[model samples]
Target: MDEVEVVVAHSERTTLRVGDVFLKVDADQSRLDVEVAAMGLAPIPTPEVLWRKPPALAIAAVPGTALGVLGEPSPASPAAWAAAGAAIRELHDAPLPPWTSRSVEEIRVDLDRECEWLITNDVLPADLIRYNREIAEIALRPWTPVFTHGDLQITHVFVDGDKVTGVIDWSEASRGDAMFDLAILTLGHEEHLADVIAGYGDGADRDVIRAWWSLRSLTASRWLTEHGFDPNTPGCEFDVLRTAFEAARG
Candidate 1:
């Protein structure tokens, strides 16, 4: 008998693994709808959807380990990172998804709100918040939207022997800035940015990508805390923010 393993659990959702099948349970059906639809439309590899029964979607596990995890050193080689980047380029080059993504204004507003919360709650020093907020501004500028894996965390990408095997967790998939996907994938793994950009071909702005790193970390810290996650873990979001601060000063 295959014992169930809890992959992730939070107020919003829970994912369980039973042998080769992964079960995702979310009260919000819309996210599941997006995940299923995005996988169908995506040109790159995605997990096979075995079946779905309202509030629970089952998928067959794809081969290969995750590219990496947050707050940890990646076991994957530079070649694997480059392969993930190439796959991202393919996704961005595909036709846009039917759904609309949040506008720059919306993202800015969210950033402002999250920044204030950080200051008001004393989550981070006001100076740190202000500095990162300034850095975050660069990403607010306009850009051509692409078919993006909206939450392309390294853990969502799988690789085997320097080749990208699959990318999972497509609920956040939508039309968005391509750089945001690249930034998210290499958030804490900045050392691999060059390899990813090399595989992505061209048109990458390093400053903008770094700015997105600050913006994403600042905005996500509060939510991560509420969800019982520790963004302050070494090599995680807080570290990313601190690194940005240091770079600005030096």
Candidate 2:
């Protein structure tokens, strides 16, 4: 057997890949609980949980390359992106999960807190933070909660051809704003937005989706930095923030 590959190791959790199995070791039992339950509830394909032994949950690997990577152009076809959109739509249409989701007020509070930290620490300019925060506020309105993959980064989705093979990293899954998922999936991949929305078909709000994009990038940068990632890397979270800043100025 091959040695275990470190998929991701962060302050919050660690994921290891050992051949056909993925071992997720996290100290937070609640997150693990949500992952397990969400996997069971999601209508789309998800890795089957092989077994669990506290602090570590093992699941069979989903067969396929990731749909895309952050900070890089996606090699996936438009069809594949659309397929992911369709899969997401199906998942959102499913019955709401039992878990609670964040309210608009809660998200606003966190966004304000994060923006303050970014400004105080000089992580970003005050104007940039303020501008993006104002843009993000557009999304802080009431929303009907649906089953959402809270952190639907492109890397979490696996695809073979134009079909969605599986979706991984379910710890953030919950009943939440559907546009939040759409925004996360297409975070830096803006060109693919039309394709995704086309597959999603109807009731899609572009403005709200863009608002979530700004909100997600703003709130995620500090954590990503602490977790050994440089959000300032071209085409990453910080770049997304910069783009928002430029647009706001224009």
**Whole-model Cα lDDT per candidate?**
0.94, 0.91
Residues 46-97 of candidate 1: C-alpha lDDT, one tens digit per residue: 9999999999999999899998899899999988988988999999999999
Query: Lowest-lDDT window of 10 residues in candidate 2?
Result: 240-249
State the lDDT at 128 in candidate 1.
Answer: 88
Instruction: Give one clash count per candidate, in the order shown.
Output: 0, 0
1-250 in candidate 2: lDDT tens per residue? 7898999998778999989999999989899999999999998999999999989999999988898898899999999999999999999999999879777788889999999999999998888888888889999998889899999999999999999999999999999999999999999999999989988988789999989888999998888888899999889888888898897678
Model 1 / residue 56 / CA error / Å: 1.0
Candidate closest to the true structure, highest lDDT? 1
Query: For each candidate, what TM-score against the reference?
Result: 0.99, 0.98
Best by TM-score: 1
